[model samples]
Target: MKYQLYFDESNKLDQPNGGYSYYGAYGANASVINDITSNVISIYDSLNTKSEMHFREYKDDKHIKKYFRTLNYVLNQNVNINIFIVNNEDAKNTAVKMNVDLTELRKLFYVKIPERLFYGITRYLQSGTDVEIFVDSSDEYEKLGLYTKLKEQMNAHSAYRNKCYKVHAAIPLDSKISIPLQIIDTLMGIVVFLMEKAYKTASSTSKIKSDLIYRLLIEGTNIQFFQKQITLYKWEGNEEQISEIPVSQYITEFLVYKTQYDLQEMGKFREIMLRNPHLDAKEYRKLIEYPNARLRMLQGYFDEITTGDRNISIR
Candidate 1:
């Protein structure tokens, strides 16, 4: 039987104030985790005498990205890693419910992406499997009172659902796991946490929030996706000269264009116009008033760009 393994981490929100801003996690098979750990340790042992492996020693994003990419190339060979990030809003809500005031709990909140990631992965696996979770124990465990509460909530839900997956927290980094695996896990936790912080600090309004979510999704999926779809469009043969287009602009445009294209292809434009009179009026006017295909496309794009059309858009 294959076992599911979940990993997570958290980062401060207010970097200057030492307040954390993000958290995230990934879930995969247990054997994959073991294999990843073994390989990572072997690499580290081989390189230890020549150079030391230090994740916490670096605070620069460029350095961190380089280190993580190297680790990903190694560990990802065996583990299928699915990453998720939690923004500041969600983190604040969790803290509020746990009675930890963000103003007063800065230090206690350092590197919490793991705990949040654990919660997310466990909830997802509630009805899917029987497995145990492992975590790197915090020196100040009492500060993470919210994590304990979330565990209790999961336990109650599991009992009601009659599921048997048990969440067991352990300090694998402090255990017999290979040094490389421990470092990789720690780096994963840090990256997820930073991504979350970037999401929250990027925007507050629903539109901007949706934009940020899409941006993170694109980045987490792979940086190349963003470069190809949003960034490298014109360079890659797109006749549309949108050199100054921001990532958010591309996301909104892509969604609107895709929806309109889909509706046209499915022969649903007429039906949609009939169902929504305003949409019909706009489309009819565009066809009659704007004879230019480019003008019509722009008008249609703006009209279709609603807050609810995209899944990443926040309510």
Candidate 2:
């Protein structure tokens, strides 16, 4: 079997860990990847502008619609989304207890987290499958020897080696340039935001995000993975409390996250949009910035996007 895994990490280890740092991969059979991507890309074709799908950049209702459409399509395919989360408080405490500096301890995690995620993700893969890895562009991946270490560790693991699972070294690709990278970016971004509990606040951003997540939980999306696909690690220092949790528990949290706000608003949004597919965006912009004051987003949203250009969201 030939497989491709697009990998992404949410926050840099060099930065002080906030709620947590995320490492995850979106995997699928190499054969179906093109079909999946083409279907997703077509969803964005009707819009006036082209922008990479990114969850962090999602602020308004338009972003919500784009993501809802993408998720509606991608989740039905034969794919797996696996994640490993590190408890920042546990990491910070371990740094102090082990007589190691905080910065030094974090440098180790840049490698350890990816190694763990890869192992967990491979458990469900068929034996003899060869996986090609692609990571989001980051200078630290090269400087810290991440690619070599991952390849060596995977190829040398006794279980995987016996199974004939050949793992390739990762190549860094800019998310802006790779639609595959964009898929994992938005998926991971949603996970990290939920982990950060960003929706706990009363801010407008939080409400919009809640609505998006609510859509994810809709019946057919399959956003909730089976136990075989997702692995959640608490990374506790204590011998007893340290253990990996299942997707069941993670979904338990998601259920709670959705309950923080009433769903009537989201229900109305979906119902109206389904009735008048083209009317939503038109009505949304009526309450807007003055025509003279609004300008192009200071980024490119042209016919062609190039490697050197930053992302543009011209509304």
Candidate 3:
């Protein structure tokens, strides 16, 4: 069997308080790529816009609706997205504690992005497969010989001794002209944006994003399909420390990591938006007079998340 995996990384390591960003990839059987790409281009054809299909640029109404359709279509396809999130704050703290420079610390795990993501897919299958990798173009990858290293590491990986999975090609392709990269870019955007709590603010763009999240995750039984195709791994401590800590301590640490998502910032945002929901409830009731649908979506979503009706940590 043969498979094709497309890769992208959304790592916000420089942000001191920015909690988590993901590094991962999504792809499918090699034969499926062309068809998927063609289908996505046709989706763009309907919109008649040559604008990029990335996540951060989804501020327009028509474009976002088309984005919703594209998202639904891609999620329903035969593919899997494997992600690993790095907690920036925790990672920096770990670097200091270990007496290693941050750059040196990153070198310890940077290569594992491909190795770990590959294992995530291969272990689920009953048989070994030949694989080719396509990463969004980056000079950094070329300098590091990431593709070559991936080939060597995957072919020799012990877990695949029986399965015999092979890594044939690991090359970078420009996302500007690649639909698969752009599509995955959108997917990456949604995950990163929500994790960063970018949807909590009072803005038209925030509302648009919240609506998309609602449609993709909270509405009906969407998460069932989502959970099936997406595997999210949140990484904080180094691999060595994982064994040193007790299971109870690990669980406690994870719970703290998950809940400690920029709480102080969120508090300030709440105060800026409205300290009391009840006080804003009457205003929201009157906002029907405002006649802007997207803002309403944003306000309602903000209310849902604020009131605990919807959790931001949907993964």
Candidate 4:
């Protein structure tokens, strides 16, 4: 049996102050998952200081760094882990475009994280193997709008793989099972590392080497993975007009941009734009015309421009 899991974060990838990375990991055999969860929980119980399972909200860069160090230690002891990292860059960009300072951005980011890691889980029974998928649930679960949308996306991916998969949703800190919790812990730890690395690198203070090592630790465990292809469209519009759209969506879209395009692969942006006719350079420049518009444009779109570029400061 094989499993595929999917997770979504509350905010976009590059939130300035407060944003979290959410994860979902699914596996083939429930029995194996049970064992894996038990082992992980035991390790965490040994390492955790609090009597009751309590996690400190990740605050500053220092806190983030320390968390990663400990998480890395825990993961090192446990092998054969599969994880996924999802970020909310759209929320971050919205804040920046709206002139939200770092402090305010942080506040918004922190509040938006889903309470439980396994907010959504699904299971599928097939002929040879059973497939299961977990998703980070949105606050709007009652509406069933977002949940349906996510399931649709997952089903599409499953169809592409030509496999039968099931999906389920779990609440954060729910006590139905311990193994899922352990998996969630391990997955969260890995996401923290990836997010911290990405955040630090963006801030120009990265201290880690070997991004591939981190990817292996986090994403390599999953049997199958799918990500939304993000395309950034820069339109010629006034600040007021751009601000009308929620900042969160903008940041989410940008993170998708950054994940797909980095400094070494900068040329890929042009290629993407060429393929996506709706996002021509002229339209892009026009869409982003506010203060630091260029920087905002590149935050999740292009990879090289920084906060201090002359073009961004022009207006």
What tens-digit string does per-residue lDDT give for candidate 3 at 1-315? 678888777764543345665677887887787778788788878767666788877774445546766777787788888777777777888889989976666656556656676666766544557788888778777765767766677677635466666678787899899888888788877766655657557676765665566555544455666667777776666554222112223223333442343344344445645744554533543443323444434344455557754333221
- Could you give candidate 1's per-residue lDDT for residues 1-315 as a string of tens digits? 245443334444433323333332334567765676566555555444323334443332222223433444443343333333334554466567778876444444433323333443455453556555444454544455534544454455566656656544332334233344344354444343333243334222222222322323433444433333221111111222312223444444544643454355224444444565565434654643433322323233334443223222211
Worst 10 residues of 2 by lDDT: 295-304
Shift in Å, residue 53, candidate 2: 1.3
Superposed Cα deviation of residue 58, candidate 2 (Å): 0.8
Over 1-315, each residue of candidate 4 has an lDDT whose tens digit, in order, gives 554443333233344234443333433356655555565456545555322221223222222222333344334332232332332355446667979864454444333222122222322346344444444434533244444444555555445556455344333333224334433453444344444445335432221122222222233322122121111111122232221112235334434544453443345445555665555344554444312322323333432232323122111
Write down the TM-score of every candidate: 0.42, 0.75, 0.71, 0.36
Give the runs in model 3 whose Cα sits over 4 Å from its true position. 14-17, 97-99, 125-128, 158-160, 218-221, 238-315
For all candidates in order, the CA lDDT equals 0.40, 0.63, 0.64, 0.37
Q: Which candidate number would show the highest TM-score if scored against the true structure?
A: 2
How far out, in Å, is residue 177 in model 3? 1.4
Pairs with backbone N, CA or C atoms under 3 Å apart (clashes), candidate 2: none
Tell how far residue 111 is off in model 4, in angstroms.
Answer: 23
The model with the greatest lDDT is 3
Give the C-alpha miss distance for residue 70 in model 3, angstroms. Answer: 0.6
Worst 10-residue lDDT window, candidate 4: 226-235
Q: Which parts of model 2 are misplaced by more than 4 Å? A: 124-127, 158-161, 219-229, 240-242, 248-260, 263-315
